[model samples]
Target chain A: DQQVKQNSPSLSVQEGRISILNCDYTNSMFDYFLWYKKYPAEGPTFLISISSIKDKNEDGRFTVFLNKSAKHLSLHIVPSQPGDSAVYFCAASARVVTGANNLFFGTGTRLTVIP
Target chain B: EAGVTQFPSHSVIEKGQTVTLRCDPISGHDNLYWYRRVMGKEIKFLLHFVKESKQDESGMPNNRFLAERTGGTYSTLKVQPAELEDSGVYFCASSPGTSGAGEQYFGPGTRLTVT
Candidate 1:
């Protein structure tokens, strides 16, 4: 079974609006979460991250909210711009797994910010 | 500083052929990881390396796949007698040794297509 899942395969938003992408996980051992953005033909770039201790974290126009109890997280982008269009992936890591600190990623949500 | 980099942005080969993908992590980063995303699937971890030793490879799909990070510098992943299902984008990521939150920087993926 997939440990992390992005139910939305794609999302569209107009410029200057808010874009929210959601992700869910089945493993409770996950304590740290991250969001990565990717453009076509490029590698994923680190966007933002949140630890289980905090419910929310924001970086400029990007914000990430985490609900550990619900095993869910969401990424919010304010005033979404045309350049914000890309694929966003949610990843989680098990806190107890050492040396093997690999991440489990969601399928990804393609965000399109139309001008 | 240079980001993680992957070689041969794209590769196409027939079934039963062998292919080797390479990754170069950022300088001084002690942790390297290998992950892949098949068509219509989430990115899955393959293995992780702490310097020259493999810390975990449980995610490796089968015996045909092999990974090595010799001398703790660069890494290589080889798939022998590849199958059509092995086609996808392979990603490499790295993190600092003391990163407790597990924020990994990813490299542009290498797309592998098995005909």
Candidate 2:
């Protein structure tokens, strides 16, 4: 079963506009969430993250909002640029009693920002 | 400092062959992880190592896949008698410590094709 899901397979936005990507999780035990951006043939790069304790986290042009009650999260990039076009993945991790951490990832959303 | 480094960027071999993928984590990072993505699928975690011991390996698919980390620096994943279904991109990531809040640095990934 896919615990994390990115419903949109692709998205397109104009440069300087806001790009929003959504993700959902079925498991309520997840306590930490992260977003990674990946280019073709390269590994995913960490972009931003939000903890379950907080409703939102912002860094530069990227902002992530979490709604625990809905088991959902969204990433927003304001003034999107062409360099922002890439595959974005959402991942979650639940606190383990044994002190080890592992992440569950979503099937990435491809975002294209037109120049 | 350099990010994670992976060797043998691409490999193609016949079925039933043995292949080994290597990863060198950051100089002082203590956490290591392995992940893989098959065609049109989300990236999935395979294992995690803390220092020299494997902290979690629940994501390992089968006995044919073996992972090792010597001296807690670099890691090697060996797939023996690889099956056609094993064709995928394997990624390696590392973090500083046990903090679930830490960011994970990823390698370029190794693409393996089994014919």
Candidate 2: which docking quality band? medium
lDDT of 1 by residue, A28-62 (tens): 88888999998989988989999888999999999
**Per-residue lDDT for B6-103 in model 2, tens only?**
98999999999999999999889999999999988999999999999999999999999999999999999999989999999999999998555756
**Model 1 Cα displacement at A59 (Å)?**
0.8
For model 1 the local lDDT of residue B99 reads 81
**Error of model 1, residue A60, in angstroms:** 0.8
Which residue pairs of candidate 2 clash? none
Best by DockQ: 1
lDDT of 1 at A86: 96
- Can you list each candidate's DockQ? 0.85, 0.80
Candidate 1 docking: what grade? high
Query: What's the true lDDT of residue A61 in model 1?
Result: 97
Looking at model 1, residue B115 earns an lDDT score of: 97
